[model samples]
Target: MERTLHLRLTCGLLASAARLTPVPFLDDFLGDRARRLMVDKTLSAHGRRFPSKQVAPLYADPHGCLYGCLLSAVKLLLFPVKKVLTWLFALRYLTRDLSDAVLLGRALDGWLEAGRLADATDPPARLQEASLLRSAFDNAVAGTDMQLLQGLLMKALRGVSGLPKAAWHAVRRLRRGGAGADPTEGLSQADDDAMKRGTAKLGAALETPEARAFLEAFDARLAENVRILEARHASG
Candidate 1:
C-alpha cells in the first residue's frame, strides 16, 4: 500500500510536468541567457584561474540554471492547473537530479564568493544568480519529499563554502540533530538551533528584505513539507 501510494504520487507529479506547455522559444532564450551569464562571468573566469579543475564546476552552474529555467517555464505554462502541482513537480525535478543539485549549488556559491553578500566590502556584478539559487531552494523545500528536501538543503550549503564558519557549523549541527529521528518526526532542537543560527548569520550579512523573506519562506515550506510527508506515512 505504501509503495502503491508512492507510485501514484510520483505518477501524478510526472503527469503534471508532462502536461505543461511552456513557451519553448522563450524558455530556450532565457536558458541560453542564463548559460551565457554563468560562462561569461563566473565559469570562464574560474577556468582561466584553474583550467584543469574548472570544467566540472563551470558546467554544473549552467546546467543547473538551464534546468531551473525549464522548471520555471513549466510552472508558467501550467499555472492554471493549481499552484500545488506546479510546486510539487518543480521540487521533484530539482531534487531527483544530482547533477542539477550540484549545478544549483555551484551557481549559488559563485554568487556568494563574488561578494554578493550584504556585508561584502564591494558588491558583485549581478544579483541574479543568488536570486535563482534562492528560488530553487524555496521550490525544493515546498515539495512533498522530506528526505529530498533535506538533501537539497545540504547540497546548497556545501556549495556555498564561503558562507561563514558559523553557518557551516550550524549545518553540521542540524545534520546531527536529524540523525536518529525518522524524517517524518520533524526537526529536532538541534535542527531548529542550526536553522536559527544560519538564518541569523545570513540576515546579518545580507540585510535585505528579500533575503529575510526567502528565509521565512524556506522555514515555512520545510515545516509544511515535513508535515505532509509525515501525514502520508501515518495514513499508510
Candidate 2:
C-alpha cells in the first residue's frame, strides 16, 4: 500500500509535468500513459496479472467517458487564462493530476477488494464489481471539495518554489522553438532533473500533516462507501 501510494505520486508528477510539453494533445497521451503505468504497478502489487488494457474496460463506461470529456473541455477553456500566470497554471495542473492520482489509487484499492470478495476467476462477477466500484468512485470524486485539494497542492508546490518556475521556463523554451521543436527532443537533462525534483517533492508532500489529514478524511469516506456497496452486491 505504501509502495502503491509512492508510485501514484511519481506518476502524478510525471503526468502533471507532461502538461508542460508544448505539443498539442501530447500532454493527454503522456498523462494517460502515466495513469496506465500506475494501474499496472498497483495490479502487480496485488499479484494480479491483469494488464491495464484488460482492466480498462472493466471500469470504463459511457458516463465516465462523458465526465472525462467535460473535464477536458473545462481545462481547454481555462488554458488561455491560466497560461498567462505560470504559478497559477502550475498549481492548477498539479492539483488536477495529484487529485486524480488520489482518486485512482483509491479506485484501484476498491477494485482489488472487489476481486478478493468474489471468485477471482469469475469475469462476470469481477466486471459487475468494477462497474459498481466505478460508479461509487465517480460519485465520490464529483462530490469532493476540489478546492481543498487545490489548496493542499498549492501548499505542496510552495514548499519547493523554484521547481515549478524552472519547469515553466522549460515549457516556454520549447514553445519559442515553435514548429521546429520536436516535443520528444525538447526535453533537456535540465527539464528531466526538474521533473525528478518535482516528483520527489510530491512524494514528500504526501507525507505532510496537511496531506495526511485530508487523505484520512477522504479515504475513510471513499473506502467505507465502496465497502458498503460491495457488501450489498455480495448479499444480493
Candidate 3:
C-alpha cells in the first residue's frame, strides 16, 4: 500500500506541512538470501511424470508447518548429506512464517498509528483516517509479506550452525515468547551509535501535537502486540 507524501520545507519550518513516511519501501525488509529460501526450492526428483525441469516449491504456505515437516522428511530421505542445510532453512522459515507476517504487519500499523500521534498531521489525523495508510495496513494485517518476515527471521538466525551458544540464546529468546529485555533485541545489534543519533534526530520531530499523543500510548501498544504474537504462538 502507498500514499503520496506532500511536503514543502521552508526555513526550518514545514510550510505546506511535512507529510513524511518514516518507514522505507518495507519490501526492503527481506533480503535476497531468505527470499530465495522461502519462494524457491529445487526438487530432489522428477515430477510425477518422467524427469523434467519443472520443480514446484516445497513450502509455499506460511502456516503449513506440518507440510514443511513432511517436505523436510522427504528431502532427508533422498539426499541426507547434501540438503540438510536447505531442509533446515525451509523448516525454520515455515515454522512461524504466517504468524510472523501478522506480527510484522501489526508492527508497521503500530508505527503509522504511533506516527500519526507524533505531530499534527497535515489533513488532521482526526478526520477520517488516511485511505492509503489504511490500505497499506489492511494488506499488512492480511500477512501479505510472508517472504519479508521469513527472510528476516532467517537472517537473524544466520550463522547459528557455527555458533551453538548464540543458537541457544536465540532459542531462549523465542521460547520466552520474545518478551525479554529487547522484544526485538535481535535487530538491535544492527544499530550503531551513529544510527542512534540519526534516530534521535528523527524522533525529535515527534514534538508536535499529533505525534505527542503517541508517546504516552507507545509502550502499551508495544506490549499488546507482543501479547498478540505470544498468544498466537501458544495457541498453535
Candidate 4:
C-alpha cells in the first residue's frame, strides 16, 4: 500500500508538470502516458502482467476523452495568447490531473484485488471494470470542491521550483528499476517539503465524504462481481 501511494503521488506530480507545456494537446499526450505508466505499474504490482493490447481499452473513459478533445480545441484557439491565459487554466489542470492519479490509482488497485480473489482470467473483464469505474468516478467527482483542491495543491507546490526536477529524477528511477522504487526520493529540502504537503493535501481531499462514498461504491461493485465469479467457480 505504501508503494502504491508513492506511485500515485509520483505520477500525480508528473502530471502536474504538464502545465509547463506551451502546446495544449502536447501536455495531454504526456499526461496520458503518465496515466498509462501508472496503470501498468499498478497492475504489475498486483502480480498481473497487463497485456499490451488491453492498455488502451482499460484506460478509455468516454467522457474523459471528450473532455480532452474539447480542452485541446480551446487550447488551440488560444495558442496565440497562451502566455497570458495559461496561468489562469493551469490551476484547474493541475487539480484535475493530480487528483485523477490518486483516484484512478486507488480504483485500479481495488479492482485488481477483486479480480484476483475471483480468479478472473479473462483480460476483457478489465475493460468492463474500467468502464464502470470510470463512469462512477466521473459522477463522484462532480460534487468535489475543485476550487479548494486547486488552492491546496497550488499553495503546497508554489514555492518549490525544484519540484519538476524531483519528479524527473523519480521518473528516471522508476524506469530504471521498473517497480518498487519510491517516487518521492532524493528531493531537495524545499522539494521534499512541498511534496509532503501536497501529498497530505491530496489525502485530505480524498478523505471527504464524496471521495469515501466513491471508493465504497466501487468496492461494492467489485465485491458483487467477485461473489458471482466465486459461485461460478463453485458450480464448475
Best by lDDT: 2
Better of 1 and 2 by lDDT: 2
TM-score of each: 0.23, 0.62, 0.22, 0.61
**lDDT by residue (tens digit), candidate 2, 66-176:** 687778867677765544563457657787877888667766766676554233556665555556666666666776777776676657556654565454544444344
Clashing pairs in 2: none
Per-prediction RMSD in angstroms? 20.7, 6.6, 21.2, 6.7
Computed on alpha carbons, the lDDT of every model, listed in order, comes to: 0.37, 0.61, 0.30, 0.60
Error of 3 at 90 (Å): 6.2
Residue 197 C-alpha lDDT in model 1: 46
Which residues of candidate 2, in runs, are more than 4 Å off? 1-6, 17-27, 57-90, 110-119, 159-196, 227-236
- Model 3: weakest 10-residue lDDT segment is 3-12
Residue pairs with backbone overlap in model 1: none
lDDT of 1 by residue, 1-236 (tens): 22222222222222223223243433333322223333333433333332212232322234566676768867567566644554556544433432232333344344445544323222231233233444445455445344533343434434333333332233233234422221212445564344344334322432345434444555566445435654664698
lDDT, candidate 4, at 223: 53
Model 1 TM-score, all chains together = 0.23
Best model per TM-score = 2
